[model samples]
Target: MSIAETASPSLAEADRFRATLRNHPAGVVVITASVEGRPVGLTATSFTSVSLAPPLVSFYIAESSTTWPALRRAGEFGVQLLTEEQSDLADRFSRRGEDRFAAPTAWSRGPSQVPLLDGASAHLVCSRFDTRLIGDHWLVVGEVTRTLVLDDPRPPLVYHRGAFGGVSALR
Candidate 1:
């Protein structure tokens, strides 16, 4: 049988798969972009590095995401590596039908007019490299054009078991 034929569509299997991923910790990030002179952003835990030689990074956005339509049109975007203190910020961007860029968001425009969140541990400005539909989400790859590391020393925020947390460094 083909790979698709072997896939289980049962809700139990889906729950099991989600539970497995929940046990694995993931770094949290806010993906930001500007479209038609407006800033849009969302929280994501699926952001990851794809390459090093040419500096490529990637993140997956759901196909049903309301923000995807606008983000898909942008030529450039920003990725902010959140600190442990920015869990509220993460929650803010994750919600739907709310003004994510409203006051108290504390962000500014970066190169290519991408929205850059303030107080993040690091910021990466990227130009859109490739995008393709994969399963129920869109796989977006970007080429890093600029990187900014904050001088502040703080633990990075992480997501695990449906909550936000910080990690301790092992020396």
Candidate 2:
């Protein structure tokens, strides 16, 4: 189904749905985009793989976010799947108006010409596909054009129940 065709639940229902969703562990990701050669990044835990065959993914950003507007205009963006050791980076990106890339964080260019954080569990370089206004947020769909995966073993950074957690294999 198309994003615009999807109906959103009520506010209370959405809140309850989010509460239930918190129980499902998700890998943290930092979405990056460049506006006028200036880079902006934001930490998001709502990212998900939409399709492997078509190499598609989706993430949600609050409509109130100032960052999303720039990203939406950028046309292309990068998603950096954070590792456990990158919690500090995640915290930095999550903050507003901070120099996100200030400290010594390794980065490289993605297909979007956006900075993809190094040492991440994975990276997906995508072009904007479709966006839909869903209640208080926007559901952004992207078509992955390139990807990077680390060879080193590392756990993912996870956010749950308003707290941070570490990822682990489900064995």
Candidate 3:
């Protein structure tokens, strides 16, 4: 049967799906942008590279996100890949009703005035390429305009089983 014709999953099934996916690991990043001349950002594990030929990336933001209203207005944004050491920073941005760019948080403005988080393993400054409503979230696509790489040797952060962690070389 077609997806639209299928019955919606029960709440228990949905919870099971969420629990099952918790075993899968995902890289962490902070998506930032400036709106009304002020910095705004949020932690995201949905960030992923979509293409290499044209240097594109994509992430999903919930439609109910409080930060989405301001973030949607920006023509450009910054994506900072977090290191394992920045789990607190990740936790900070993921929270609600707080000044995410306060004194303790280090950051600077970059091209197009996008807010760039300091001490990240890498940063990607991107121009909004496309955005569309998909289910309950917006799928945002960006074209990379600039990239900054740090010399830090720390492993990139990842989230799995509802906890932040670093990876070890398999080989």
Across 1-171, the per-residue lDDT of candidate 1 in tens digits comes to 766666755666899999998999999999999999999999999999999989999999999999999999999999999999999999999999999999889999999899999999999999999999999999999999999999874899999999999999798
Better of 1 and 2 by lDDT: 1
After superposing candidate 3, which stretches have Cα over 4 Å from the reference? 1-9
Q: Candidate 3: lDDT of 171? A: 100
Selected candidate, larger lDDT, 2 vs 3: 3
TM per candidate comes to 0.94, 0.84, 0.93
> Candidate 2 vs. truth: CA RMSD?
6.7
**lDDT value for model 3:** 0.94
Candidate 1 residues lying further than 4 Å off, grouped into runs, are: 1-9
Alpha carbon lDDT at 150, candidate 2: 85
Query: In model 2, what are the clashing residue pairs, if there are any?
Result: none
Q: How many residue pairs clash in all the candidates, one count each? A: 0, 0, 0
lDDT (Cα atoms) of all candidates against the true structure: 0.95, 0.85, 0.94
Tens-digit per-residue lDDT, 26-141, candidate 3: 99999999999999999999999999989999999999999999999999999999999999999999999989999799999988898988899999999999999999999999
